[model samples]
Target: MSAFFPALTAGADPGRTAVRCGADTLTYEGLARAAGALADRIAGAERVAVWATSGAHTVVAVVAALLAGVPAVPLNPRTGERELAHVLGDSTPSAVLAGPADALPAGLDGVPRIDVDLAPAGAGPVRTVPDAVRTGPGPVLLPAEPDDPEVPALVVYTSGTTGPPKGVVLSRRAVAASLDALAGAWSWTADDVLVHALPLFHVHGLVLGVLGPLRRGGELRHLGAFSVEGVTRELGAGGGTMLFGVPTMYHRLADALAGDPALAGALAGARLLVSGSAALPVHDHERITAATGRTVVERYGMTETLMNTSVLPDSGPRPGTVGVPLAGVGLRLVDDDGSVLGAYDGETVGEVQVRGPNLFSGYLGRPEATAAAFDGDWFRTGDMAVRDPDGAVRLVGRRATDLIKSGGYKIGAGEIENALLDHPGVREAAVTGEPDPDLGERIVAWVVPVDPGSPPTDAELAAHVAESLAPHKRPRVVRHLDALPRNDMGKILKKALPGAG
Candidate 1:
């Protein structure tokens, strides 16, 4: 196939708007020219580091790097100087791009820096001709011989909550396949204008939100930063047809619309609204639907595999489940002994293993780490899950985040939370294992009460738990919360919980 992006832009009007940043809009043609110029500027660099906030500049810079056959490492703009210095030391990028020169990290003193200017909104005539640097090119060719599908296309670092972030190498074929799979799975078409607000450095934003639309010749309206008011305004402008947001974003939108019916009417034009990156609580889901009259389709994915499963059309999206594997993806659950668990029995819960085109090739520069993540061709997703009779996959929880060994007993916190959610007064619950001096670890329950006035006491919750759970499974400590600390995707930050080790 011809280079994927050029094919999408071919025959299309170059002046058609490709990105909208605040008051500025960059047409497809303008974006291409800027990308080409940026590519030429970094032509001599083997790899380039870009520290940018969400916007057109970051997107174009990334695309330009890919076009120029250089590996682009996009770091969070909020990354601190020490961390940036470490990345600079590791990658030794030939150049760096950021919004402010003074904000640049200490180690990038010799690296060339480029500042991007946001295009003015409807301020000037459309330029038909490509810029000099872009037009001067005879034939743009991929610099690296990426014939080996396993070679790294982009190196994305993890968020590093557990430890220092390590570079994950996503291959060209892998990234392309992910885009294709997502497009096919969602039935995305050129007519679709995706309203994207997620940060570009994240996989969900880069592959699914940006590349997926571009690969399908779809339009993208990028919001610089996610804000309830900004999104409401964008929706009212009549361009966005679909939206993908994290659970926290959904909750915020719901809260905004709940107080204003006009805001809800503005969002009514969207065909679908999706939630991912974390489990979307049932309350939030119901609230969003009540506010916007749109069902928030929740999907499950990770950094290693962009998207493995989803709640799709025709399949009923059960309240607590993440639906089924996406099209062209295969999933198998394996026990601790490596026995492949079949989908026939609904009750079988095991470690989720995935084999799909969307899976990342390997972790960059870490062969042992990459090898440990896979079992032959199937990637060993550390998540624990179960497939029900309806073929829906219910995420039990992450293996690393789930099982707790305490007092000579293995406990599954998800099972406890599931039990607690069934209680009348419990709106939301999260169970975590806390380190104990004598018992090795102890189960702690953090609950959001439906009625704050009559919240369930520790003894009351213990009695309820005792009725349903085994002796060891019952939580010894119970904490009540108005809301749990959650990320943008609404995934609870268990590690950040009070009294958590």
Candidate 2:
């Protein structure tokens, strides 16, 4: 595939603003020139590490790396010395770019450093008009072969929600395809302005938040971090027509918007409101729609596959289901015997697998794990899903978190959890199988109460569950907590729960 950035830059209006951060705005022409200059400076480097905070400098660094035919590994600006050391050791980048000279990681004695702030514009009569780098006679078009669709382009490390994080390798074609599908699916236009508040390192922000809009020549407003006050201010600033966020972000925004009616007017200008990276609770979805007069389009995706499925237009947003597969993507429900389960029958529940151009090449540098995840190029998603009669995919739960074997009888924890969540008093619930000598394992339920002071007693909850579920499927033990443990994305950390290990 061709370099997407160059193509986008070639087509964009050079005088139009590309990125806006706080009071800073970089025009497309200026951005391309800066990226080209920086690319020329780092032409010889194989790999480069970018450690600057989110802003114009960081964007330039990323574009420069791509232009120079080198892969850039973006580290969280707040990354500590120990974490930086680990990343440096793992990636062995030829150079590091930081905001300040002192921000550089320690112990890299011999590696050459180019202060991004001080990089000079290329010498020669400056071209007045914007031109495609590929078409121009310059060092910017380095000698690089056509990108193999399978070669790793971006190495994004997992968030370690379950265990030790691994770097996921996504190919150029995968990233390009994901961008194309997202633009086409969302109906993105050059007139669209995206209010981006998430960090850039993760897939949600990198591919969807940043590259997706850039590829379509849409403007991006980058916020340093997520905050209700900051988001409200940016939304009110005008020109923000689209919003993307996680569940936690939506909850915070909903609370903020509820207290202030004026905030609703600011958000009313947006055309699309999206929630992903974690499950968007049904209650939260209802609250957001009621407050903003916009439906939160919740989709399911992971780092391995940038995006596999999404809720489409002309469809009523299902509260629990994540809609059907995206265009160019194929979804399958497979049993242990490798039989493809048909979606026509609503009762079928099996492992969700995806085969498509959007799927990643593999996990970086981990052949064994990568090999195990694929069955003839189809990725085993490890998620247990049941498709309804309307073809909407409702996630039952993770296979690792669902099956609870007790006395040789395997029980699905999702069934029990769903039953518990059905209770009006139950706010959030998680079910895990704790070891028991008598039954081999017993079902344990951890619940967050709707009202903290008036949480239902264990006996009451147990009896309530008994009415709807089988005797064996009811929770043997119920533990009330203030809240269920969730990660940065608002996904409940099942592995962290008691007896989950």
**RMSD (Å) per prediction:** 4.4, 4.1
**Per-candidate total of colliding backbone pairs:** 1, 0
Across 1-501, the per-residue lDDT of candidate 2 in tens digits comes to 125564324444667777887656777666666666666666666677776466667777776666566677777766655666656676778887654444555555445566674234443322323232343343332223235655556667676545556667677788888778877777877788888777777778777887777767778888877877666676777668888898778877776777887678667767788888866767667777788777877777888888888777447656667888888988888976999988655556788999899887776567888999998889998888878887888776787877677776656666677678778788788888888999998889999988989988888888877887667777888888887887655678887775467
Relative to the true structure, candidate 2 reaches a TM of 0.85
Weakest lDDT window of 10 consecutive positions for candidate 2: 123-132
Tens digits of lDDT, candidate 1, 47-138:
88777567777777776676566788887766777777666676777777665433665556777787643331222222223322333434
Candidate 2 residue 143 C-alpha distance from true site, Å: 9.5
Q: What are the lDDT figures for the candidates, one per model?
A: 0.72, 0.72
Instruction: Report the poorest 10 consecutive residues by lDDT, candidate 1.
Output: 119-128
- What candidate 2 gets wrong by more than 4 Å, as runs, is 6-11, 77-86, 101-114, 118-151, 160-164, 345-347, 402-428, 436-441, 460-474, 498-500
Candidate 2 positional error at 378, Å:
0.6
